[model samples]
Target: MHNPSSTQVKIVTADPSAIGLFGLAIVTLVASSQKLGLTDGLSLVIPWAIFLGAFAQLFACIHDAKHNNTFGMTAFGAYAFFWFATATSWMVKMGVFGSELAGAVDGKQLGFAFAGYLVFTLFMTIGAMETHKVLFFIFVLIDLLFIGLTFDAFGAPEAFHKLAAFAELGIALLSLYGCGAAVLNTHFGKVFLPVGRPFGIFKARS
Candidate 1:
């Protein structure tokens, strides 16, 4: 007679940053086109915002959580919800919810919301500095985007909105690069694309 024993194996998870960055890239690219006056309608932008911006990042957030990456989880989750909220806001603005809801809209509330996200992105920018150059620049552009968005929300100037439009475009470009780097580097098992090293500013000495 023999006794049976069972063994446990840990499952490996793939990095979610590539897909997340791709989502960010597509949505921002589309939305920035509208803000830059290259597009005429939010109707065309809504689906991408909901699917690529909100859903994709939200999916990355779940995987990041599984990987025990606190920063990644928080960043992806926050931006995912931000996109969701923005899509809903656009719907309200377009009177999709109802005329009464659209009529009751308070633009200042958007100001407050953008201001809050600006604050959130600032801290996240610091964290991104530790990741890689591509990601760092992406977050830096994100910070600028939020800054411009915040000011524009509060009626600062058209310049601020323009700044946000450009910054958002920058984010889309950088995110696409990041997505490529993540995929190619992992697939090749080498630094096929240089993302640069993390800054030594914050780590403690050994």
Candidate 2:
């Protein structure tokens, strides 16, 4: 019989949130490319949804699971599933699935979806803030993304589309930063963030 205390468990010292950050970055950049007409909308959006949104977040969730980080795991895993579902929804809308339900899901229905996502994002954002600065930035970007998505869903018109694009760009930039920070900190095996600085304001109270 193996003694659990004596068993050498290799702790995962690296932050998994980097995956989500980088994933959001890629998603936003590709979305911007589509909005700018640099690429066909469907062509770029599909890859963004699948690779960036789905797989990237899924990778983070897997790492969190390995670390036994319930909060991180739940946050990343839920979003990963959300991305997968939304990706399928996009494919269905593009007529790839041949489902009549896709046709019936207009902008308003999509708006409701965004609203639901925004609620989820809030919960995840709270969790993110408890993690680190890199994660905190990602949460902020997620909040912006949800806001933009909700607005677009409600038929806010073309100007709001630009706002969404900019928000996405912000998400990408912050994601890249978060990714860099995670990689650097992991390699160094040191606490790089300043001591006594709480990622969440509420956490400082405790």
Candidate 3:
């Protein structure tokens, strides 16, 4: 009989960070289109937010969790929920849920949401700095987007709205970079760009 102890198995998987970076790209592009009025917010924005932003990231989060990649899991999961909430909010605003609920979701409620995302973005920015160039740019743009979003939510002047559009555009561009990096890394099996150690609770498990 063959000795089981003498045999060994090793499984290799793609990088979770790469998957996350790519998802952000698609999410930002669609979000920017909505912000820029290039597409109808109701018809297009809702679907992209739910499908690409929410579902895609959620899928990445599962993989990250399996890898015992705390950084990848939390980062992807939090953003995944963010998109889900954003989609729900949009639906509420559009009266898809009900007129009464739509009326309840006023500017102040949106302001609070913006505030929450601002904090979330800031924390993620720090993590991005530790991740890689593609992710770092995305995080930076996300921080900018939150700033513009918060301002608009607070009933800022029309100028701030314009600023928000620009920020969203920036997000779109950064996301493209992230997407490119993900595809390349997944296929190449090599880190074209070096992303250093994880920050905070981001630890690799054995």
Candidate 4:
């Protein structure tokens, strides 16, 4: 039997969350190390930002879209672009785009970008409550990260930078755990690692 109405009804794809979370973990871990004064220079960080932070998440977002995972797709896609944009901004600041353009860059503008992401992450955090504890924790840390980044960009106290650094580190740790959970759970054909249940606060209204 052939159906012209649709090419294929069943769409199969591996869960992309593991790789997505791994990419996020790698980027944040490296970035936080710099912010924590344990490392220096973003020249080394740029490649990770582009490959792991941007490309890996973008790949996850694409597969997520194929799976019809609206929330996952949008979240991964947004953050994927966020990494790409931030990487480009770093290049500009480093004078890769010429001295004049680099000189014209403003830190406050990055504050605006961070603030916008804070708002976006807030709503997504609510959605994550229904996903799993690991993901929910990740969102919470993301909220904190955005908060710190926004305030730090706007010239807030050094404490804000510290806050962001710690938050980013937390994101990395939780994301690594999430990545492992996603992989092991699916591969073992059982819950090898538990992510915990949803909050159930938003169960469908009957």
Error of model 3, residue 154, in angstroms: 1.0
lDDT of 2 by residue, 104-198 (tens): 76877778877888898788778766666666666677677777778887988777666667777777777777677677677777756432334
Q: Total clashes, candidate 1? A: 0
| lDDT pick, better of 2 and 4 | 4
lDDT of 4 by residue, 175-202 (tens): 9999999999999999998998888899
- The candidate maximizing TM-score is 1
Candidate 2 residue 188 Cα shift, in angstroms, is 2.3
Query: What are the lDDT scores of the predictions, listed in order?
Result: 0.93, 0.73, 0.74, 0.95
lDDT-wise, the better of 1 and 3 is: 1
User: Stretches of candidate 3 above 4 Å error?
Assistant: 1-11, 190-206
Off by over 4 Å in 4: 1-9, 204-206
Encode model 3's per-residue lDDT on 17-83: one tens digit a residue: 5556556667677777767778765667777778878888898898888888887798889889988
The better candidate by TM-score, 2 or 3, is 3
Q: Count the backbone clashes (under 3 Å) in each candidate.
A: 0, 0, 1, 0
Off by over 4 Å in 2: 1-14, 36-38, 99-102, 190-196, 204-206
Between candidates 1 and 4, name the one with more favorable TM-score. Answer: 1
Candidate 4 clashes between residue pairs 3 or more apart in a chain or in different chains: none
TM-score on alpha carbons, each prediction: 0.95, 0.80, 0.81, 0.95
